[model samples]
Target: MAYISYLDLPKHWGLERGDRVLLTSDIMQLMFTTMRNGERFDRDAFLDAILGVIGEEGTLLIPTFNWDFCHGVAFDYHKTPCKTGALGGFALSRPDFRRTQHPLYSFAVAGKDQQLLCDMQNVSSFGVDSPFGYLEKNHGKNVIIGIHYTDCFTFVHHCEEVCGVDTYRFSKTFTGQYIDAEGQESTRSYSMLVRSYELYEATDLTLIGEKMERAGVAHVIVLNEIPYRIVDLTAAAPVICDDIKNNSSRGICKHKLQ
Candidate 1:
């Protein structure tokens, strides 16, 4: 039986020292491979390895977004679970982690930038103050594990907002009860730049992901049969924004309106 060491993650995942990264992972897929050879995957150990690579100066963020508030259920920052996956929910329980208050697209952050991220309570999910916006402002890296680009490349929405691509999205408000970290409950309204899911067919984004890879802004790697991508938001956003602004069909939206 072979053993896996947390120390090996930096080289295996192409993680750099002092890097700020937003991690999005499919834990089930990662566990299937990493837990093989009579070994088990330790969530805490894995997180520690990631932190070790980034060091004291770096920041780590995990998306703990849930859309329950949009469905009329109250959003309790302490109670609402992340629909995204296991890692995000796990991060939320850590004493050192700080959770943002965006309701629909909140993030749980650890490391030096935790307080800065915690202060970002954007009323709109994709607006300038959202986590997506903050990531671009900080020139952070996006690490995606065992998931397709279409499912996790939320920065595209930030690019859309930067480019003012409002043709595909509209501002919609959801009002509901919200409980803050201190247990203060209040009725509030939050806005979302919702895509016209019913009127438009989903565009395949694999092509753009490939394009970013070729452009050198995104690095693609496959380890133990699970695919991963690391992209620099500072470099990739401009290219993506240009593609969206120039091309009528950038492979992410329906060419014809319904």
Candidate 2:
């Protein structure tokens, strides 16, 4: 059984009124029934559940994985159903934004201060053509959160090895544009990747924590059992990985709880 309850998560995670919360894919699946017997995708219900948590001015963070882009081409992970990518569903549902080209990096928003930082690839074919692109345009003060996996950020490292440029020299960009159902166009851009490191040593946790703090995010709760170090955030960073050999399960890091 899982340790957290999606319905009761706000209270369990100690979320106060007006606090923003992020949900991972595992949490999303556990909370909403988008798939019934593995068939229909309940788009409305999924969106409603998310909106329920994000009342107003509240943010939700989600990781967008680009498995398809990395498979065989970049980091080959020998596994079936390996060609999947990640998208911020909340961002997709918004009104002012729309994803343009390169599904992985092309989220567009209409607001002046809206921020989305994606570090995954393979988003080229993710139904980001219609209303998805709409939300990409109006991202103003509302926060549409995005995150990258520990391994994906290594692109910066790859650039160093291949181009001889420092990780600091590399920058990722995401662009979005508008199009009618029949197809017309307009565009915008944002930075995606920041830094890189080797897989074993690569982790954006510190940066993630810093961003959360800057965003005024209060409590961060982990559902997995993977052990990790909490660098700059005040919340308890728990290990929720199920693999016993994983660092969290083995308590490899003293900062992590077993």
Pairs that clash in candidate 1:
none
Mind giving the per-residue lDDT tens digits that candidate 1 earns over 1-258?
234343465567666777889999887976766666455788887888888888888899998989999999999989999999899999888887789988999888988888888988688888888888878888799999888888988888777777776666767899999999999999999997787765556867787787788889898877666677899988888778877877743745564452
What's model 2's lDDT at 170?
37
Best candidate (score: lDDT): 1
Candidate number of the best TM-score: 1
Instruction: Please write out the lDDT profile of model 2 over residues 1-258, one tens digit for every residue.
Output: 354433333333433333333333332343333132233444344444544554555444332333333222222111111122233444455564333333333332222223432222233222222222222232211221123323222222222222232333334555544232245444433333334333123234344334434445322344333221111111212121111124332211122233
Listed in order, each prediction's TM-score against the native is 0.93, 0.35
Clashes of each: 0, 35
Clashes of 2: 35
- Cα RMSD, model 1: 2.1
Clashes of 1: 0
Q: Model-by-model lDDT, in order?
A: 0.81, 0.32
